[model samples]
Target: YQNDIGQREAERGHLARELHDNALHQLLMLKRSVEEPTAALEFPAAYELLVADLRQIISDLRPATLNYGLRPALDGLVDALSGRDENGPAISLDVSGAGESYGPEVDLHAYRIVQQACENALEHAHPRILTIRGRLEPDLIELTVEDDGQGFDVDAQLDLAKLVAHKHFGLAGLYERAAIIGAELQIDSAPGRGTGVRLTWHSRDK
Candidate 1:
């Protein structure tokens, strides 16, 4: 399980590098093109547009507030998820906590968990409302992703001979991640109801 988590982390790092080096680099260059066109264009208007584009690009790169604190990081994450194209469901993100730094592994795992949940909602659930919430105390951080969509029968799935015969990896992946951070992953879903997943980690203080 440790090896699997390590491999996934490596893959995520590689993908992040590709996004930063290729996609973000192009966006920055495009932003510069409009802002640095010599005296050929309206300087003020072009500069303003470029500034907005640059802000978005930089936000995509690292998120300004995320570096400063948790609220910003989550704000940036919600913004990114909510900004998905027309196919994406409406999403609401709520965060609460005093400023405190978490281990990099915790932050990364939390971010990836939300990312996966959002993907599942978009590609599978077809939800109308998706809410991502995060709460932190002095000793723990809790994250939850809930969607008002058709849910599944967890028990039935678990009982299925085929599923038991071949290990399903979706929930397993999340379980492994929670273990890495000494956290717990709770999944609640019932047919005809909605689905909600919770990830909670013990704080260093604890």
Candidate 2:
């Protein structure tokens, strides 16, 4: 399952790279071309917004940072989001258990799970503070994304997550990803205590 997911991710990354280098560049050039001094009031602005959305989709489809090791990839994730809005949820990244490295598949899935969790926090939770924690233990690797935001009803959301694509939730996808890697997932949230998503897989699972 890990191998299959890895291959799919690789293909998505390749396609993302191509779109970014070819199609996205063309869009940029077109935007520049339409930026005439007397162009319509909304054309340039709308096109510019479209270009930005394309870039974000490319990034989300497959994170380029995962090409590096997991720690740096995690760093890249934080770096990409940290400066996007000065007033947006402040973020911090902490990595512990020095000199321990999981295999590539573990890193890949874990990275993605954390990334999605953060996106959920930012988009749904409306968090004021976001944090990612990575801890590599002798027997297990744990990754956590926690937030300070308006929490939700975990029971209802988890039920809805199980129904994704129809009545689904974003965390539903994360649950499947965790399953593929043999990781146990825990979601803790309430009305005001914020949300925390934790994924832990045994080292032997690698």
Candidate 3:
């Protein structure tokens, strides 16, 4: 358990470094060019390309703030996942309620949960309609990702033997992350039916 936590922390650190060295640095350089307009650079094209790359980097970071506060981050995720043009599956995002901030740990875990849920829907179930919902209540925040895709047996598949053998990928990781945040994760799905995932985080202030 300690090792796993350490590893996760390390990954977060690495991501932070990547953001600082790569994405932030590039943005700064681009900003300089934009400021100095007569620096022999093409007007819109260079600026546009630079901005696009910066956006891509920001998208890659996908900071946890989106998961804990405002709907913009998750909305960005939905838009990106939906791609430049909607391909096969249709994705929707809806967020409601107040409180747009959370502890760093809670935010990070929530962000990861959403990310994992989306990946599972895309790769495993290949759903036709995918929805990501976020609701912030007085004492808790709830996030749900639903997919009208083929479901699986949550219980049977979660057998100790199977889990030990490293079968399911995303759920277990999600469960651990939720546990870290003192949150609850619910997976509702069955064969031939759609999947609904619910994650609830309690407020620290009580």
Candidate 4:
């Protein structure tokens, strides 16, 4: 399953690159080449929207910031979510103790876990404020995604059979990813309290 997910991510990145280098480039050129006033105005406007949409799709498939590092990628994620709408929740990142290098797989899984948590909060919790915090050390890395949103019953939701039956895979996927990376996963939530997904990974576990 891990190999399959990695292969799919690779294919997504490849497709994103192809569309960016070929299709997006051609669209820009075509937009610039339009000379007529009306055609130029309309075409450029439409092309701009298309370009923005394509860029978002590409980013969704594979974040470009991941190439730099996990911190930048998580920063990008927070920025993107914060800018999603004028009324969107306030999102913040507070990370300390950097200069830690985990393998690409670990970094990617960590990002995905946070991403999934944030998405779940937005979709289900209607959070007012979403926070992502990280603590990186030589032997330990701790990451948490928390949201001030309407929480659910953690025990009921964590039933694997029930989750599969309900077609709700977000939480399940987080567990799977944590297990894949040998990380300890924890969820803290209640009926009225907010939800928090915390992941801790030890170097020794790797």
Q: For candidate 2, give the lDDT.
A: 0.75
Q: Is candidate 1 or candidate 3 better by TM-score?
A: 3
lDDT of 4 by residue, 19-134 (tens): 77766876776666585555565676667766776776677666888777778888899988898888989999998876245778888888888998998999999989999997
Clash pairs for candidate 2: 164-168
On the 0 to 100 scale, the lDDT of residue 151 in model 1 is 83
Candidate 4: where is the Cα deviation over 4 Å? 1-41, 99-101, 204-206
Model 4 poorest ten-residue lDDT run: 2-11
- Pairs of residues at least 3 apart in sequence or in different chains that clash in candidate 4: none
lDDT of 3 by residue, 1-206 (tens): 64355436655776788767765766666666677877436545555765766676565565634655645567667877898455769998887876466756676677778878988888889789999887967678789999999999988875534553463546666777788889999999998898998999888799
Clashing pairs in 3: none
TM-score for candidate 1, please give it. Answer: 0.66
Model 2: lDDT of residue 191: 94
lDDT of each: 0.69, 0.75, 0.74, 0.80
lDDT of 3 at 188: 92
Give the 10-residue window scoring lowest on summed lDDT in candidate 3.
160-169
TM-score for each candidate, following the candidate numbering? 0.66, 0.70, 0.69, 0.76
Cα error of candidate 4 at position 164, Å: 1.8
| Deviation in Å, model 2, residue 178 alpha carbon | 0.3
- Tell how far residue 75 is off in model 1, in angstroms: 1.1
